[model samples]
Target chain A: MDLSFVIFVEVLYGVASLVLISAGLAVVFGMMKVINLAHGEFMMMGGYATITAVGYGVNVFVAMLIIAPLVVGLIGLVVERLVIRHLYGRLIDTMLATWGLSLVFIGLATMIFGNTTTGISTPIPGFAFGGYQVNGYNFFIIIVSILLVITMYAILRGTRAGLIARGTMQHSDMASALGYSSDRIYMMTFFCGSALSGLAGAVLAPLVGLVPTSGGAYIAKAFITVIAGGPSLIAGLVSSATSFGLVSQFFTFTISPVIGEVALLIAAVILLRTMPKGITGRFFKGKL
Target chain B: MSRRASQDVTITLVVSAFLIWFLPLMISTYTLTVLVIYGMLGLSLGLIWGFGGILCFGQAAFFGLGAYTYAITAINIGESTLPMILAVLVPAVFAALLGAMMFYGRLTDVYLGVITLVVTLILFKFMNSTAGPQYAIGNARLGGFNGIPGFQTLNVPGDPSAYIWGDTYFYVCALALVIVFLLVTWLLRSSFGRIAVGIRENEVRMGLMGYNVAARKTMLFAIGAAIAGLAGALFANWGEIVTPNLFSLGQSAEIIIWCIVGGLGTRFGPIVGAAGLAYLKFMLGQQSMIDNTLIMGLILVLFVLFLPRGLVPAIETLLNSIIGHKKRKPKPHRMRRARHG
Candidate 1:
């Protein structure tokens, strides 16, 4: 029972973090079709923000939940204005441009923090679950991911802003015809996407050592999740993340973590080849 | 061809020939040979990306594959020719398989880029983890992070013991670079090359016009991979060591930067871009005044934003304006259908 329960938590933890890392990309790339290659870098920045804030004696949760998002969101706003605004529909160009942005972020981070690995200890201590020692922090990540999903769902589904954002994403010209400014919507959406990325990075910072190019590690997984999720926003993200996360963790538990990573990639390749449009592209068609 | 076009070609040929024959005497063998390697790598990428419009982000995978193949084969076979052939063949086959999956599966451009990048990262990760004794390919021990070293290098085709090194190696590489350049130039002017370029401009349109779009793209990709493999083979011999860093994201990014900076889709662009950027990088390494990564990032951002046409096309436009259309200028492929007032 303890082993199964531990396995369950590990799988959930994997899924949750996958959801967290890919959420921002779902909005920015999936909705906006912007193909932001610098997404991992944004997450990196978020991690840095939380760390720096914690270093200055801010509460870890507060630094992660509020300050990191705000800092990264603001940076996103600046980036959107200066760079992304110019390459709205040019998908390939945006990829190249944001790739450059990612490099810049990594470089700047390296310059400021040096190329050393740094991290803070998990705020929550381990607790015994029956005979096994369970990481109490895993529960925190699970809860955070759940809350994030709810927030994104509520805002994108229930709110007026959400409707406008959806409308803008689906048909910017049509939305513009209806008296909504596409530029404002795009900027605000990018800001939110960036904030979400920041939040994901900040929340996960304690789990792993942070380095300047740490973003590169996250990029492939995030992209795989988002792309494999396909056209549907929330549904696709959830489904693909669930599947990939499970497969990776399964391999991790059974054989080794390195094999798990390889399994995830192989799964992606097979998944992409079979269903070019993605899991959501096939199953959750017309879903939000 | 017109008089001006033939004249331009002859002049270019003469200049390149002179540079190949003369420059090796003046420059250090190390610098010239390394430049040759980048030039070859850039040439392959330039063909695929510039002409074929397949913007691969993981081209270093082929380069690394070729190097590894050569290293392993040369070690076992105790000869250069077979390993050299394998070096090119290995990457070409890998590329063909990968490209068929990507292009035939009708993957969108974005996903294609993502998938290629992931493949590269996978190769890097897998290679890095192969430090254990279990990971052996025949006679060559696949050294993980430490990489394989002291592999048999290039020599006379018939003789195994007669090894080529230093200036002789440099000259061979220089000659190879020039030959590849000329070969690429000839290929670009061929009917098949036109089809590849046309596909880049409009894939569906070409598909509709009864062309085997995917097959052509796969061919182009394979050819590009073969050249990159050759470059990698040379690089392994030049560096006398092969590390997993050869397949790194940084290396991939550098390849892309070279193609972009030199001039994507142009014959001479990749060579110039690779040579120029590699030199700039070497210089930056020697200096401590500025951060190299930061500058590279800045260059990427700035170049994309302001100089998307890259150095070559930008210069062409500038020269055209200066001469005020005194001669009939050849328009780059991007200019649509000769728009006249």
Candidate 2:
């Protein structure tokens, strides 16, 4: 019974982390229809921001929760005004331009960070749970993700700003006809998406050693999660993350971590093969 | 044949002949061979991406598969001929399977790109972790991060005793590239290639017109994979080593940059792009003061923003404006049709 409880926590943790990793990409790609290939880089910059802030003697929570997201969001705002703004409707061109941006980010990071791994220890300590030790940080991540989902749902569903953003995303001309500037909406949405990515990176930095190219490791996973989630933003993100998280964790506990990743990718391929429209696209229909 | 067609053939032949003769003297066989291999790789992508309109993010996966397949087969059989053939065949077959799944599933372009990227990254991750002795397939060990080296290199067909390397190998690579280039040009002019391009322009219309768009796309994708495999086989011979880095994101990104910078939809553009960029990368590798990736990234951004039509198309436009009408002039309508064709 104790081991099962531990396993349950692990699974939840897995699902939450997947959600966190892909939240920014979900906003950018799902709503905006812009493939921000630099999504992972934005997260990487967030991680660096958190580390730098913490080094400058700020509170760890403040560094992670505030500074990192602000820095990365500002960067995103600049990227939006410059590159993404120009290649709005052209899908392939946007992908190429963003890919170039990703490379540029990686190059800049390598130059600044000296191409070496840097990381901080987890603030929370491990505690005993029956025979196995449970990471206290896991609980922190699970809480953060729960709160994130609630906040996103509440804001997007409840606020007029969210409605305007959604309206602009669906039909910019219609949104513009109603007195809201679609350009400003797009710019703000991009900023939020980028900030979310940064937050995810900052929160997760304690778990892994950070490298300039660490973004590459997360790009595929985040893309798979967001793509597999389908159209309905929050519902799709939660459901797919839950399913993939369970599948990957199950395999990880049963076999190995690498096989777990392989299984997740294979599952995604099979899922895409079966449901080309994604889970939310078929089932949720019109839920945000 | 049309006068324009014959003229194009004559120009291609003359250029190939001149390059084959002159390039060896201008640069070392080592650098030239690498350039030729990269050119072939770029052409593979150019064929599918430019003509077929499939922007695969993992051409490196097939390239890596070809290299690994050749290395393993060569080590086991101790013959270069079968391994080289297997290299091409394996990636082609793999691509056919992958392409069938994506195309038949009717996934969107973004999903297709994401799937291909994931698959290649999976291969990269898997290959990097296989450092144990149990990872061996027959006599060849999957050397993990250190990669597989010390395999039998390319030799004359059916004769293990005769080895091919240096200048002879460069000549063979250049010949293969020329043959592939000419074949691709010929294929594009055929009815099947025209249908493929038609599907690329409008898949719904092609489907309505009774052409099997999915099957055509899969076939084109397989052909591209085959060409990339051929290049990978040559690369293994040139470098005499195959690492997991062959399947890296950077390698895949570089191939796309080559196509974009050279000019998409043109046969010669990819070769010129690959050769020029790869040579630049080689030069950059010799110095460590400035980051090579920074320069590459800046170039990709600049090219995409300013030179979207690429170097070849831009130059063609320039030539048309400057001296096109004065020399052997043609009607503007014919020129437009030729451009589309």
Candidate 3:
């Protein structure tokens, strides 16, 4: 029973982290179709922001929930104005440009952080749970992801601004005809997406050793989850993350973490092969 | 052929001849050999991306596979000849199989890029995890991150005792590059190549015209992989080692940047780009203050923003304007079409 509980928590933690890492991409790539290749770098910068803020003696939660997101969102706004705005409709050009941006971010991070791994201790500690010791941080991540999903659903589904953003994503010209500034909508959406990415990185910074190129590790997994999720942003993100998280955790419990990663990638390939349009495209038709 | 076509061919031949005869005296043979290998790698990508319009993000996967295959096969067979052939064949077959999946599935561009990048990362991770003694094929050990070293380098065909190194090795690599260049140039002039380019321009139109778009794309991808594999094999001999770094994201990005900087539509542009950038990277490695990737990223962004036509095309435009070449000055749209074609 204890082992099963441990396994269950591990699985949930895996799924939650996947969701956390891929949420920003789900918004940017899934809704906007902008293909921000620098999504991972944005997360990396967020971690750096939180770390820097914490080093300056700020409260961890404030640094994570507020400072990181604001900084990254502002950065995203600048990028949107300077680079992404110019290449909105051109998908391939946007990809190349963002890839260049990712490289620039990595270089800048290396210059600032000196290319060494730096990370903070988890604020939450491990505690005895039955016969097994569980990291309390695991539960924190699970709760955060649950809250994130609910918040995303509430905002995107409940709010008027959300409706306008969705409308702009579907048909910017139509949204413009309806008196919404699609450009402003796009700018705001990108900022939110970038902020979400920052929050994720800040939240997860304590768990993983941070490096300039740490973004590369998350990029493939996030891309796979988002791509595998398909058309409906929330449903696809939730469903795909749950499935991949389960698959990877299952393998991790059985074999090793490396094999777990390999399994996730293989599963993604198989998933893409069978359902090229993604899980939401097949099952959750017309869902948000 | 048109008079323009004949002139282009003559220029290519003259350039190749000039490089083969004069370049060995100008630079160290080792650096020249490495440059030529990179040139070949760039050409492979140029063929698929520039002409076939398949923006593969993992050309390094095939390159690394080729290098590994050659190292393993050469170690087991104790001969370089069959291993070299296997190097090309392995990546080609792998690409053909991979291409079939992507093209036949009718995956869009972004998905294609993601899948290729994922595949390359998979190869990298797998290769890195093969440090254990159990990861052996025949007598060759998959030497994990340390990579396979001390493999028998390239040799005279049928005579393994006669090792080809130094000046002769440089000449051989240069000759191979020249041959690949000419073959690619010839291939582009063929009906199949023209159809491939057409598919790039408008896939639906090519499919509607009764051409096998998927099959053509798969063939072109396989050819590109073969060339990349050959470059990898030569690279293994040049460095006398093969590492998982060959399949790294950085390596893959560098190849794409080379194509973009060199000029995508033209055959000769990638070679120049690869040689030039690789040399710059080599120089940057000697310095500690400046980061190579920073410079590369800046260059990519600036070029995409202002000089999307790339170095060769921009230079050509400048020269045309300077010399007042009337024949070259067609209507703008027609000129663009003619240049790409």
Candidate 4:
């Protein structure tokens, strides 16, 4: 019974983190349709930002939630103006350009942070649950993700700005015809997407040691999650993340993490095969 | 074939011939061989991405497969011939399987890129972790991150005594490069190439016109993979090591960079892109004032934004504007028609 409870939490934690890792990408690639290959790099920057801010004596929560996102979001904003703006409709071009940008970001990060893996000790220590001791950070992650989902839901479904963002994404020409500036909308959406990526990175930094190339690992998984999620934004992200997280973690606990990672990929491939339009594409139809 | 198309083919053949003769005196055998192999890698990607409009982000997956296949097979068999065939066949077969899944599944372009990249990562991660003794295939140990080394290198077919090395190896590889280039050129001009280009231009239209778009794409993808595999096989012989890094995202990204920077859609563009950029990178590595990544980033951004046609196409456009009124120059669409019409 205790083992099952611990397993449940582990699965939840997995789903939560996957959601967190892919949320920013969901916003960017899911809605904006800009394949931000440098997204993982942005997350890396976010991790660096949180670490730097924390070193400067900022509160960890503040560093992660506020400072990291702000820094990465600003970078995203600049990237939007400089690169993404030009290659909005051109899908393949954006992939190549952003891949270059990803390389640049990795190099820059390496120069600043050095190539070695650097990380902070987990703020929330391990606590006993029956025979097992769970890292309290897992709970924190779960809570943060729950909060994240709620916030995303509120912002996207409830707010006028969310409506505008959604409107612009669906049909920019139509949005422009309604006297809204698509450029500003795009920039702001990219900023939000970037900030979310940073937040994910910052939050997860303590869990995994941060290195210059740490982003590379996340890029594939985040992309898989976002792409497999399909079109219905929040619903797709949550649903796919849940399914994948459960599947991967179940395999991780049953076998090994290597097998787990492989399972996720295979699952993604299978997911994509059956539902080429993605899970949400077939099921959700129109729900945000 | 049209007169102009044949003329361009002849020019390519002549250029290759000149290079086979001229390159030996100008550059060292080592550099020449490396450049030739890199050019082959770039050329394959140039065909898939530039012509077929299939941007495979993880091309190094096939390259790595070829290298590992060659290195392992060479170690076990102790003969270079089977390993060489295995090198090309392994990647081609793998690509055929992968391409079938992707193309037949009706994957959109972005998903294709993502799925291919994931596969490469899967290989990289899988190989990186295989440090144990159990990872050995027959007599050849994977060696994990350290890679598989000390394999029998490429030699003259059927002769185990006389090894192909140094200038002889360079000449042989250069000849192979020329042959591969000419073969690709011929393929590009064939009926199959036209249909592939047509599908790239408009998949829906091609599908409507009774072409099995998916099968053609899969075959083209396999051909490109075979080319990449050939490059990988040469690379293994040149470097004498097959590391997991061959499947790395960095390696894959570099291949794409070569295709882009050199120019796309032109026969000579990838050769220029691969050779020129390889030299530039080698030069930059000597000093390294600014980061190479930064330089690469700026080049990619600049190219995409300012010069989308790449160096070769851009130069061709300039030549067309300046002194060439009668020159039936290669516009993308006309090149499309020239290849298959």
Cα deviation of B145, candidate 3, in Å: 1.4
Q: Write the per-residue lDDT of candidate 3 for residues A162-258, one digit (tens) a residue.
A: 8888888889999999999989999999999999999898999998899998888787888899989999999999999999999999998899988
lDDT of 2: 0.89
Give each candidate's fraction of reference contacts reproduced. 0.52, 0.46, 0.41, 0.57
lDDT of 4 by residue, B36-151 (tens): 99999999999987778788988999999999999999999998999999899999999999999999998868778778988998899889988899999999999889999899
Off by over 4 Å in 3: B2-7, B24-26, B328-341
- Pull out the clashing pairs in model 4: B262-B273
Local error of candidate 3 at residue B121 (angstroms):
1.2
- Docking class for model 1 is acceptable
On a 0 to 1 TM-score scale, where does candidate 4 land against the true structure? Answer: 0.96
Which candidate, 2 or 3, would have the higher DockQ against the true structure? 2
Model 4 chain B lDDT-worst window of ten: B332-341
| Best DockQ among the predictions, by candidate number | 4
TM-score of chain B of each: 0.94, 0.95, 0.95, 0.95
Model 1 over residues B63-136: C-alpha lDDT tens digits?
A: 99999999999889989999999999999999999999999998757677778888998899899999999999
Q: Quote model 3's TM-score.
A: 0.96
lDDT of each: 0.89, 0.89, 0.89, 0.88
User: Taking the tens digit of each residue's C-alpha lDDT, what string does model 4 give over A60-133?
Assistant: 99999899999999999999998889987777777778888998898888778888988877888898999998
Error of 2 at A127 (Å): 0.9
Each prediction's TM-score versus the true structure: 0.96, 0.97, 0.96, 0.96
